[model samples]
Structure formats: C-alpha cells, structure tokens
Target: MINNNSVTFIMAGRRQRRRRWLLVTGLLTALACILCCFMLLLGNTIYPVNEVLRALSGEQINGVSFAINTIRLPRMLTGLIAGFAFGIAGNTFQTMLRNPLASPDVIGITAGSSAAAVFCILILHTSGAIVSIASVIAGLITVLLIYIFSRGCTFSIGRLILIGIGIQAMLNALISYLLLVGAQQDIPAALRWLSGSLNGSQMDELPPLAITVLLFAPIVILLGKHLSMLELGEQSAISLGVNTDMTRITLIVSAVCMIALATATTGPIAFVAFLSGPIAKRLVGAGFSNALPAGLVGINLVLGADLIGQFAFDVRYPVGIITGILGAPYLIFLLIRMNRKGDL
Candidate 1:
C-alpha cells in the first residue's frame, strides 16, 4: 500500500497540477492588467500610457488628468470590481450546485436587485446610498424566496433553477410595468441602468463596493475548500463533516451582497456573472480552485466589452448589450445540449 513508486507518482501529479494552476492564474492576471491599462489609455482623446500613469499617481495634466482620474478611472474601477464580484459569486453558485447553468444571472438573483433598483429610481425617487441599500436588500430577499420555494423533500438544483427562472419572469414583468408607468424623465435613466452602463459612474459610488469585495472575497476563498466539498453532494459533504446548511447560507449571503452592489454600481452587466465562471473553468482546468481565476475572467470580460462597446462599434452600445449578445448564444447552445441529454 505504501509503495515508493506510487508515492513518487502521486508527488509528480501534485506538482503538475500546481504548475497548471500557476500558469493559468498568471496568464489571466496578465490579461486583466493589460485590459485595465487599455481601458485607461484608449478613448475619444487617447492619452499616452505615461500620462495615464501620471494621472493615476495624482498628477495634474489637464485633459489627461480629467479623463484618467475622473471619468475613465471610475468606469474602469467599477468594471474591475463588479466583474470580480460577479465572477466569484457566479462561480460559487455553479460550483455549489454542480450545474454550469446555475448562476445568479441565469437564475433570478440579479433580477431581484434590478427590480428593487428600478423601483427605487421610479417610485422612491432615490439616488446614491438609498438605491444601493435597496438593491442589496432586494437581492437577498429574492434569493431567500427562491430557496424557500425550491425547498422540498429532497434538495434539487434543477428545481431551484426552475423556480428562479419563474421568479425572474415575474420580476421582468414588474420591471416592464415600472417602465411603462415611470415618468418620461426617469425612463432614460431607468433604461440605461437596466441596460447596464458605466458611462457616468461617480467615484464616490465605488467605496462601498470596494469595501464589500475586499471583505467577502477572502471569506469566499477561505470557503473554497468547503465549496469544493459541497460538489460531492449534500449527503457526501455531510459525511465529510461539512455543515452543509450553514456553509451554503453564509456563502449565499456574501455572494448576494457583492452581486447586488455590483448591479447597483453597473446595472448587472448582463452575463459577466454567468459567462465568467464557465470560461475560466475551461482555461484553468479542474481539480483546483477556480474562483479567483473566474473573477479575473470577469474583469477581462467587462473591461473588454466596455472597450468594444465604446470604441469598436459606431452605435455605442452599453456594456450589458454587448455582454448579452455574447451570453445569449451560449445559453441557447447549453439549452440545446441539455435537451439532447434530457437534462432540461
């Protein structure tokens, strides 16, 4: 049982896995950094990377200072933070549920936040702090409702997803109703938020999200091992001494907190949450923690799409529209594949 050859083989396998993880993470980090710089330097009046760096370092350089420090900086930061949050939260759900399709975006978590935020904009006539608070509260409530409805004699990811879809449909209708009754002046703002743009994101609006991401991300990463364990199914995870219920609740709350804030900050940003996880998984492979890598993918997706939406297209679409285009086909393909296998 303790053969020297077997021990050596196991050691070699572990080393190989470690190397793959390192390579994937390093590539993702580099890609994210390049995109971040690109976001800063490319715009209507393209600034040199040096000028951009100067502005970031608190230098005052006229157009470069205003563009880099004020306008583009907030937008870029929002994308990075929100993308990371979305990626981590989405990947968490997918991992816990063992279903590629089981993401907050696909389910109804973001919709909850969206509905609340839209309501606040239209009904409450709220802005800033109140709106963000409402979004977080709404998102938590929506997930709670989904969980309650989906709870049955046995735990079922499929059932939860189905219920979430139904809830999403209802919430979409509510959002449409608000749009119909909303004032003409508010409609544009509401639509823009719904479509998810970072055009005029204020610097002041970022601190809450930054703090949230910093706070909960470590918790999620710490729980990554437990998350991986949960993949073994509830009974098996419990057998392995995981407090299944407690772990899920804590993870869900932390994730919803990040997702809601990000949605409030950037209007859900379409499939950043849904697409980032699967994409990162493909690149990073299995048998290792993919949470951080997934977050990196999210940052890249958001920044890249925002860049493309801003510069690549003449029409100047919102980030959400571009992400929607990217995500919709994959969703359809997934559905088709699932149907063929009778999983739908």
Candidate 2:
C-alpha cells in the first residue's frame, strides 16, 4: 500500500492539476484583456491600436483623444470593472451558499438598487450622484433585511433563498408601481437605465465604483482560502477551526459593497454574476479556488456580449438585453432541474 510508484503517481497528479489551473487562469485573463482592447477599438470610428494607446497615454490627438479617451475608454473601463465585480461577488455568494441560483440579481439585491434608482429618477427627479447614492443605500438595506429575516433557530440556505425570492417579488411590485405613476418623459430614461446600457457612462462618475472594488477585492481574494471552506457546511467548517459566522459576515459585506457599486454604475447587467462562476468552475476544474477565474469569466461575458449587442445585429441592443437572452435559457434549464429534484 505504501509503494514508491504510488507516491510518485500521486505527486504527479497534483503537479498536473496545478499546471492545468495555472493554464486556465492565464488564458482567461488574456482573453479578458483582448476583449477590453476590442471594446476600445471597435466603435463607430475605428482607430488603430497605436492611436488608441496614444490617446490613453494622455496625448491630445484631436478626435482620437475625444473618441478613445473620452468616450470609448470610459465605457470599456466601466464594463471591465463592473463585470469583474459582478462576477466575483456572484461567485462568492453562490459558493458560500452552495446554491447555483443564489446570485444577487436573482435574489433581490439588484432589485433593491433598481427600485431605488427608479424612484429617484421618476419621482424625485434626481440625476447623477444622488441616484447612485440612493441605489447603494437601498442595496445595503435590502441585503441586511434579507439576512435578518432568513436567520431562524438555525440558518438555512433553502430558507434564505426562499426569503430572498419573496423580497424580490415585493421589490418588483414596487418598481411596477413607480413606473405606472411616473411622467411619460421620465419613464423612457428609467426604462433605458433598467435595460442597463453603458451608453452615457462618464469618466468622472467611475471613481467611487473603482475605489470600492480596489479596496474590497483584495479582502475577498485574501479570504479566498477560508471562503472555499464555507462550502463544506457550517458544522464542518467549524470543526476545521474556521469561524463561520465572522467569515460569512466579512464576505457578505465585502461582496455587497462591490455589487452595489457595480450595479449603481452600470445597472444589473442581466446574469453576469449568475453565469460566470459555473463557467469558471467548469473551465478550471474543482481542486482549487476559482474566484479569480470567475471574475475573468464575468469580464469576458460582459465585454463579449456587449460587442455582440453593438455589432452583431442590425439594430444595436443594450448589453443587458443580449446577456438576458443568453442567460434565460440556462435559467430555465436550471429551474427545471431543481424542480425535478424537489429543491424549488
């Protein structure tokens, strides 16, 4: 049972797994970079890569600077940061809850932000900074309430999800009410924002979102080791010397900050968070933590879908529309599977 060949074979297997994980992560990161570059270059007035770089380097190349640096660069950066945040935040929730359907978009956090932003837009006639501020506040309150209501004698993932669904339904109803009583002039803008376009993103508005991600993203990554242990269930995690409650709270707070900021910046980009984690896991396999991989997948999906929405069809659609079309089928399939298993 303790032969040298057996030991050598096990070592070799680990080495192979390490190599595969590295390869997958590297490839996904590279792909995201390529998509980001394409997002900058492939617009109405296409510029050469060198000119785009020149514009980025703060050189005043007239139209090129305005187009690339002013317009396209901000849009691309918005997509890049927001997509990564959604992906990482969504994956953290799904992995921590051990449920594929527990993303913020599905569970009402995004709904909370949407509802507040719609209210500010249609009713209060707010714009820019105030709307973003309102959405962040609403998102945090929604998640905190969800956590409070979902905690019973003992915490249950199933119960938390059920409660989140109910909250989502209520928020959707609120959004509908706000829409119905709104002025015609305000409704179209609200609808367009709800549809989640990066059309009018400004460089000035991105600092808060960028700052939030920069601060919390490292916390999430640093805790990635403990985060992976969460999937082993609370009792198991505790037995292994992990402080489950502290770990969960830390992660939930960090993730919510990123998710709220991202949503405020770009609205909910359909299912970027919902779809990225599983895809990353499939690509990277299971022996290692896939947080970074999942973020990369989110970046790729958002940027790629945006490109498709912009150029693939005769009429350009919002990025959310394309992602919604792609994610709907997957959602239906997942629902059917869960229903058959009596988990819905």
Candidate 3:
C-alpha cells in the first residue's frame, strides 16, 4: 500500500501546487504595491510614497495631502476597481466560452455601453447617474440580443464573437453619427467619452462602482470551481451533473454586469480585459485557474497605463489611448503565435 513512487508523485504534485500559490500571492502583493506607487506619482503634483502615506494619515505637506487625498486617490481607486472587475469578468467569459478571445469588450458589451453613453451625452444632454443607468441597460440588452441571435445553435463561441463584431461596428457607426450631428461645444465631451477618459471621475461615482465590484467579484470567484468544471466541454459537464445552460447564463450575466459597471465608470478601458488573463496564466504556470491573478494584472495594467499617460508624455492623454498603444502590439504578437500554432 505504501509505494515509494506514489509517495514521491504526491509530494511533487503538492510542491508544484504550493509553488503556484506562492507565485500568485507574491505577484498580487507586488502589483498592488506598484499600483499604489504609481497612483502616488501620477498627477502634476508628484508626491513621494512617504508623503502619500502621511497624507493618508491626515497630515498635510505643502498641499500634497490635498492633491493626493482629494484628486489622485479617487481616480486611482476607480482605475483599480474598474480594471480588476473587467479583468476577472473577461477571463470568466473566456473560460466559459473556452476561447482566449472571448471578453466583454470583444463581445459587444462595452461597445453597447459606449453607444448608449454617447447617445445620452450628445442628444439627451444627460450626465451623472442617468448615463450610467442607460449604459448598463444597453449592455444588458446587447447581451440578451447576442443570446437570442445565437439561440438557434445552442450558442457557439465563434458565432457569438462574429455577432459581437457586427454589433460593435454598428455601435461605432452610431457613435460617429452622434458626434458628427452634435454641436461643436458638445463634441469635446462625446469625443472624450469615445476616447475613454477617466479624467473627471469624481468621488461620487467611485463609491457605487467600488461597492458593486467588491460585492460581486467574490461571488464570481466562489463560482470558479463550477466554471472550471464546466470547462470540460458541455456534454462531459452535463454528465457530471452540471446544469450547463443555467451555469452559462449565470456566468454570462455576472460577467456582463461587471463589464457594464466598469465601463460606466471608466468609459471602456481597452485591452486590459483582453490581456490580463493570458498574461496571468503564463506567469502562474497554467495549471489552476487564473481569475484572481488576471484581476491583479488588470489593476497593474490600468495603473501603469494611467501613470504613463499622466506623466511620461508632454501632453497628458487618456489611459485608454496609452493602453491601445502598448497593448496593440502585444495582441498582434499573440495572434501571430496563435496562428503559428494553428489556433487562429
């Protein structure tokens, strides 16, 4: 009963699992610290970590406290929350669809939000909570449309993505039409939204978004075991007593909510959703799921992009543009590699 080879194999497996866990924990901690540092250094008034800490502790140093406490803190926190939510949500969709390219931004949810927000901004002259509500509704509608359109075939991932691409094109065209038709004075706001700026995200917008993400992310993570179990193909999963359709619908709705909330706050940050999961899987050696690590990577990506956009260039650009600049090439590389492996 006590075979040496079996004991060694068990020991090796435990070691590998332990190592992966340690790596994930370490990466999460490091990325959080890095994001904190970036937030401290980002704005025009650069404050050192010590000063930022003192500010958090309610100490003022040359108005650095005000700058950090009042302005940069809210912006940075919003970015972190939005990025983390989008990342986890994106990976969940990808895992659900069993395709790396499946993400909320890719699958029309973000585009839907953008179109709704653009309409509100250009035509209704609505700002504040109305826009967020409309955007979330549009996002849900888009998700429902995708489901209805693909209901005939039991929903293939390929068809879903193709449908999403079509929807995205139409939404973009509508946004273009709105921008072209709107007054010159309002074009700035519409264009700012289209370009995905976090510039004016105030303290008020942060609280609800932060609460939503905090409340839902753990729920999604708790369902991670079911997600992974369902990933073993639908028939196999069904055989294992999983309610495949219900599971898929639940995950899809949860993921869409996360993306909608994030897009409402940050105006659809680019590529952090598309990039985080794969980067996390590669970093953590790919055995267990990468949901949490993907979320961490997302936070790092958004924080890093915001820092670069804020300080690296002479003119400050939106973080989304910076992410587009940095992430496009990485995406291209991933495509090329996938093509080489015949996965494209």
Best by TM-score: 1
Model 2: residues >4 Å from true position, as ranges?
Answer: 1-10
Model 2, 110-190: lDDT tens per residue?
899889888988999987778778877898899999989999999888888889989999999999999999999999888
User: In candidate 3, which residue pairs clash?
Assistant: none
Root-mean-square deviation of candidate 2: 1.8
Q: Model 3, range 199-269, lDDT digits (tens) per residue?
A: 87678888767877877788778777778877788888888888888877777777777788788778878
lDDT of 2 at 201: 83
**lDDT of candidate 1 over 1-344, digit per residue (tens):** 56998999988988898798899889989999999888888888988778888899999998889988889888989999999999999999999999988899889999999999999999889988888899999999999899899999987888999999999999999999999999889999999999989889879999989999999999998998899899889889999999999999999989999999999888978988999889988987767888888889999899889999999867899999999999999999999998899887
- State each candidate's clash count: 0, 0, 0
Cα error of candidate 1 at position 72, Å: 0.9
Q: Estimate each model's TM-score.
A: 0.97, 0.95, 0.91
Candidate order, TM-score descending? 1, 2, 3
* Candidate 2 worst ten-residue window by lDDT: 127-136
* Shift of residue 48 alpha carbon in model 3, Å: 4.2
User: What lDDT does the true structure give each of the candidates?
Assistant: 0.91, 0.89, 0.80
